[model samples]
Target: MTKDTTILLIGHGSRGREGNKETINFAAQWRERHPEWRIEVCFIEHAEVLLDEGLDRAARNAKKVLAIPFILNAAGHVKMELPHALAEARQRHPEVEFLVTRHLGMGREILAVLQGQLDQQIKAMSVPDPMTTGVILLGRGSSDAGANGELAKMARWIFEDNDHELVDLAFTGVTWPRLETVVQRQVKLGMMQIAIVPVYLFTGVLIERIKEQVARLQNQYPQVSFALGTHFGFDKGIFDLLDSKVNGDIEEGGMLECDGCKYREAAEEEHLHDHSHTAIGGGGCAHGHDHQHEHGHSHAHGCSHKHD
Candidate 1:
C-alpha cells in the first residue's frame, strides 16, 4: 500500500509476442488501478525480461517487495522455479523484505469467469438445448497430476449447477483425453452440438492451435455444431481474485492444494535428510525456509505454474 512497496508481478513468459504483450498490458492496467505501489512485470521463461532481472529492478528502490505469480494453477513453475528465484533474491537483497503470495488457484472468481464464457458460447448457439449439447473445458495440461485434477474439478463445478447434459475435461497436450479425442468421443455419444472452452489466460500459439483443431473437427463432423469459447482475458473477476490475493482477503484454506503435488512429495522426501526446501502450502517458503525464518520487515499482503 505504500509507495516504497514494490509488486513484482511475475508471469509465465511466452514465446509468442501476443502472449507476452497480454501480460505486460495486464500489469500496466493493474498499476493504473492501484497507483500506491510500484509494479514490475517479468516472465519465468522465453521472454525479454526474466525473473532474476525483474527481482533486481523491484528490490532496487523498494523497502518491501511483494512477489505475486500471475499464473492460474500451482504447477512446477509455481511450486519449484518461482520459489527458488525468490529465495536467491532474498539472500542477495537481505536489506529488502520479501513476501510471496499465492497463485490464482480455483476460487469463486475463476469459476465466475469460466461460467460467463460458457454462457456466452451457449447463447450464441442456434439451438442452445443443454440436453443434446456437450461442453468440453480444455486446459493446457501439465505433468503434475494435481494440476490436471484441478481442471477436472473445475469441469465438475461448471456442470453441477448448469443444465448442460455433459461437461467433460480435456487437455491440449502432455496428458490424457486430448481435445481431438474428446471431440470424437462426444460426437459418437450423440452430441449434436459441442462447445470447446479453452481455459487459457491469453491468446497465444495454443489458442491458435485450439482454433485450428476446432476447424478440422468441424470439417470432420459436419453434422455436429461445434462452438469454441473464449479465454479469460482481462476479466473483472480475475482482477478481483488477484486483488484478494494481494490484500490477503483469501483464507489459507483456499490456497493452492499441495497434498497431491509431486514437488511437495519430493520435498518431503528430502526433508528426511534435513533439507530446508519446503512445500509452497506449508508454513515455510517454497524454496528453503526454516519454521522460524523471518524477514524482519512487514508488508501489506501476501507456481511450477505455466500457461500455453
Candidate 2:
C-alpha cells in the first residue's frame, strides 16, 4: 500500500464506550503494525467520527481509498448501508478511487480463534467431560436470514471438530432460538456443563447482557454449570486476517458476496422487466455505482431500499 492510499476502517459503532474504544485501539495497533500506510477508523452509528466524516478525512489527501467494514457478516450494514455510504463518498470525491474489501465472514482463521476460546474455557473447568458438556454459540442476530444462517453454519463447524457433546446456535435478539430458550433446552437434555460463547468482535453492552443472562441462568439452575465465554477482542488471528484483507490482491477492487442477499434478489427481479442486471465483479459495487432497487413489497425481514 502506498502512502497516498488511505485505509478506512469502518466499524459497527456500539452504544457502549468499551466497544468503541476497542475499535479505536485496534486501529491504533494496526497503525503501529504498518506505519507506512495511513489508516482511519469510523463507526456506522452511536460513536464519534461517523462514516461520512471518516470517508472525507480519508479522501482528503489520498489518491486511493480502501474502505473495509470491520464487521463479521454480510448483513444489512455491509450490503446496503456501507455501499450507500461509499457511493455518496464517490460522488463527493470523484478524484479519489474508493474500493471496499469483504467483511470478516466465516473463515478458517475465525474458526481457529473461536476454537482457542472454547479450549480455554473448557480447560478452566473442573472436569471437562465432552460427553456431558453443551456449547451454545451465540450470535448478535440479524434480520437477514443469510447472516443468521452463517452463524448456524459456524456453530455446526465448531461442533464437528470439537469433542463437545452438543453445540447449538442461539441469538441475542431479532431471531429465533434465543439464548434463554437454548439454555433451557440444554438443561432439560441433562447437560451438566453448558458454555455460552459469544461470536462478537468486541466488548459492548450486548456482552454485559450475555454475562447477566449467564448469571441469571446460574441462579435459576444451580445444578447446571453455566460458563460464559469471551468475545474476540484484539486477537492476533483477527489482526492477521485484517492485514491480509488490506494488503491482499483486492487493491484494484474488492468483491462483496450477494448470495442470498434480499436487496440484490429484489433488484434483479425488478431489473428483469426494464433493463438487464449488469453483474459487477461478482455482485459488488466496485467503483461506487449506485444500483437502484425497487422494493414494491415487504417481507418478514422488512425489505427496504435503505437498511438504515
Maximum-lDDT candidate: 2
lDDT by residue (1-308, candidate 2, tens digit) is 88899999999999999999999999999899999889999998999899899999999989899888899876667766666577778899999988888888878888988888888778777757888899999999876666777788889899889888789999999888999999999888889998878999999999999999889889999998877888786889999998998777363444344323455555444442111112235433221113344433434433223321
RMSD of 2: 6.5
What local distance difference test score does each model get? 0.77, 0.78
> How does model 2 fare in lDDT?
0.78
For model 2, what is the error of residue 19's alpha carbon versus the real structure, in angstroms, after optimal superposition? 0.8
Q: Pick the candidate with the highest TM-score.
A: 2
- lDDT per residue, candidate 1, 1-308, as tens digits? 78888888888877789999999999889878887758899999989899899998999988888888888877767766676677678889999887777777777788899989888888889657898899999999876666777788889999997988889999998789898899888888888999888999988888998998999999999999988987686998877777877787433433333323444455545442112223445343333322232233322222331111
Candidate 2 weakest ten by summed lDDT: 271-280
| Pairs in steric clash, model 2 | none
TM-score of each: 0.82, 0.84
lDDT of 1 at 246: 76
